[model samples]
Target: MNRTDLGPQRIVCLTEETTEWLYLLGQQHRIVGISGYTVRPPQARHEKPKVSAFLSAKIDKILALQPDHVFGFSDLQADIAAALVRAGVAVTVFNQRSVDDIVAVLWQVAALVGCTQAAQRWIEAVHAQHAAMRQAVQQRVQRGARRPRVYFEEWDDPPITAIRWVSELIDIAGGEDIFPERACQPLAKDRVLADPLEVVRRAPDIIVGSWCGKKFRPERVAARPGWQDIPAVRQGHLFEVKSADILQPGPAALTDGVAQLHRIVLAWMDGQVAAVLGQGGVAQAGGCHA
Candidate 1:
């Protein structure tokens, strides 16, 4: 369909990343509604009316808006999409589970809106940025000395770890994620650490939390039982990376999340060496045995 004839002049986005991507591609005029939780770009909140939330939506309200298309993310949104579809509104759900999948979804969305050329250029630019960042991280790892084990917490109640894209970002940043095996699982239950002692056993050198739309409580994490013995806690390596910066599964995650990971890992590595030299007057520190 032509950009003018795509029948999506009134669109509703169920997630922040899709809304942000459409805005970036100059398709904001087509968006009629957005998620209540969208904070990215800042302008989206002011521009679009909030009609839905992640995993749940006001179906009647969305229908009243007369949106021709509804955009949602994941199986979590399947019901929302089905409801809209049953009401004769077209819906597209993206279930991107990896960094590559996210980029591909962006392209697909752009294509749906007849902005394929713009999407191609945008993808190329992001790919170039990723390559350059990867190279820089590799150089830093080779020269600056060490790689740390990172434990990335996506939630804390049941203790969920990083998802696939987040784990990949950690790898790109020159750090190894402690729960790499669980990264591919989409459900929180699959990624949750059943035993708090598992975290203690992993003994990560850095613990980063991004509690999925909630503010991470590092102090709360630091106070967990048996966590006092974890090296990350002892060295004050516990940190909070905002959910917007990492959990979005789009350009924001690639840019801001990877940068945050690199900064934290590099700082932790430097701190370890500094601590050893300060204590023993020697630069040698058995450099990141992880």
Candidate 2:
């Protein structure tokens, strides 16, 4: 008997994004193992045996799987990649910190799994959806609305802001990320909010909490001392977007995540317009949040 090799028959994904992408591209059958954190397609958790976590994996168990290729994400996973490499296992680690890189990763992974055509079609659809959403926001601006000020809380302990892709998505969703500079930094330490008062000072109209896999408790955020005057807290604009929907850096973040963001930001814009009309301020520039 002879076995025909289609590219990378036995694949292990050390991150949720790649696992989710492969499943989306109809290449899930090639996956031999997946990260325990994958929840985008909840069925993945049940169908695939959990073999890895975000920062660690069962190395011996992974070796036992005999994967021909292992895909990981970011410098955070460099140690795992290195260990696998030392054992002569093929490894590819991607550092996709921004929206563009994530879109590109989709195509690259699909190509490896011999599904480039399907992947390209899906990618084009996603891009089209993004463009349509941006256009809708642009129309809103033309009708006397401004982008909302958005603060995406990636972590709550020290109040880390958005990551690169989330920042870009905020712009597309008719909101301006308050901490755009922080998003450029790949490491969370660099993006940490050193001064909690900085958030109040920025005066965001909307607060989106993802909180890195934990339940986002907006009440806790509102209860922070001196946060009473913050516009988002005062106006009851704090909202929670689950990490699985917004932080994966792949289709989930680019499509569903951004859509949710657009809805939230647009609603805020509507509220701003209503407030101006109620005050009889002539609705000049609709808040000019950015």
Candidate 3:
């Protein structure tokens, strides 16, 4: 088939990221169904039929929609994608685990929807934003501003740490993910911080919680045994970045989520500069150097 002819006219997004992207690309009409967890645009929940959850889907319901294509994410949705493919439905599963992967998948999605030009424009714009952000942070680093150690908790029970994309975004936003080493682990089991005190040992300057679709209770996190000495807990540096913004692995992560992370990190770095200056240290907190 011609590449243009391969594009889907009716689509189902089994994940929030794709649904949110289509909406941003001005192609939401192509999506006949979306995941129940979609809330980025808000209108998607009311406009599209909810047909899937993160790890499960209503196969019959999806078939009834007669979508020409179905979009899903990660190995977690492998079974769902396999079932749909077995049923002779066209399915594309994107396992984007890193910042670059997210950008690559986004461009591929745009091609699938025949909106490559529009998506490319947005991509180029965000890439410029990335350049500007990197420049700003690099300057701060040269000025000896501390890149706050951040513990981004994806899940609180066993305490899953940052994902690859989130970890990269944190660095871009002027914070260092304390567990960057574990960010690329594909499974949550592999990323789990087995010992709760490990987080305390790291002595993170900030504790960011997303909790994967649940409310992040900073108090609950602070109340954990022996966490009082943790710098983040002691100084009230707890924060919540909504899962919808950071966990989606798409536009929201590249834009809104990143912006939020940057604001938090920059403020902390500025405070470090101020504290150092107050103690008669020579590094000032402004200019291209900060």
Candidate 4:
């Protein structure tokens, strides 16, 4: 019953990304427990016992599971990792804030479970998807289509903008993140908008809200003070992308997340053309169609 040769046969994932990644790599069988927030692969929710949330875990429950290794994400989980280590459980916490870091971490996780080849193949598909999006965006730009100014709201209250990986995905999806500078900040507190009016001043063509785990209320955002003047509000360009899709720093972000973004940007482009044709004037960017 020696386990070292099998590479972490019993694993616990304290976050959605690692759980989803392991499931994608066909290593879900090794997972003994998962974060309660995992929703990427719906089956995971039913198949695995939920042992942890983002910032907290049932340590006693986890211990009972006897996981050989545990995976977590970010410094937010540092305390959880520390406690696990103290109990002699091997813990690897990945702080992947950007797209490249996410890909690299996925590779490392796959390697731990002896699924490097599968991970490589999946990573290649992700790269191909990204390249295809980039090319499509380039083609649009060449055809005189303007990239929309995207304001992705990670949290509505105090208004936290997109993270680094999300910002890069916006660019690849043919939209420029209005708060690119702030998105580079690794910490959510640092990325928070000090002044709510800053979003109004930025004049984004599209506003995407993924308010952590809370449902994004478009009416609430549109009702913000002076937000009616903002182009996104005026044109009704506000949309909600589920937090599990875009906020998770893994395959979901790379695939469904970016794909949704691309569709939004493309729809905006089409709206611009329609507006120009209907008005018989120059095409103005930023208008919600439906």
Candidate 4 regions off by >4 Å?
1-5, 272-290
Q: Which 10-residue span in candidate 2 carries the lowest summed lDDT?
A: 281-290
TM-score of each candidate? Answer: 0.88, 0.90, 0.89, 0.90
> Candidate 1 on 73-162: residue-level lDDT in tens?
888888998888889999998888888998999988888888888888888987787777677667766886668898998778889888
> What is the alpha-carbon lDDT of model 3 when measured against the actual structure?
0.81
RMSD of 4: 6.9
lDDT of 2 by residue, 112-179 (tens): 87787788788889889889988988988999988889899978998888988889999988899999
| Clashing residue pairs found in predicted model 3 | none
TM-score result, candidate 1: 0.88
lDDT, candidate 3, 35-98, per-residue tens? 8877768888899999987778999999999988999887788999999999999999998888
Q: Arrange candidates by lDDT, highest first: which order?
A: 4, 3, 2, 1
> How far off is residue 240 in model 3, in Å?
0.9
How does candidate 1 score on lDDT?
0.78
Better of 1 and 4 by TM-score: 4
Which regions of candidate 3 fall more than 4 Å away from where they truly are? Answer: 1-6, 272-290
lDDT of 4 by residue, 10-55 (tens): 9998988888888887778899999887776889889999998778
Residue 98 error for model 2, in Å? Answer: 0.4
**Candidate 4 C-alpha error for residue 162, in Å:** 0.8
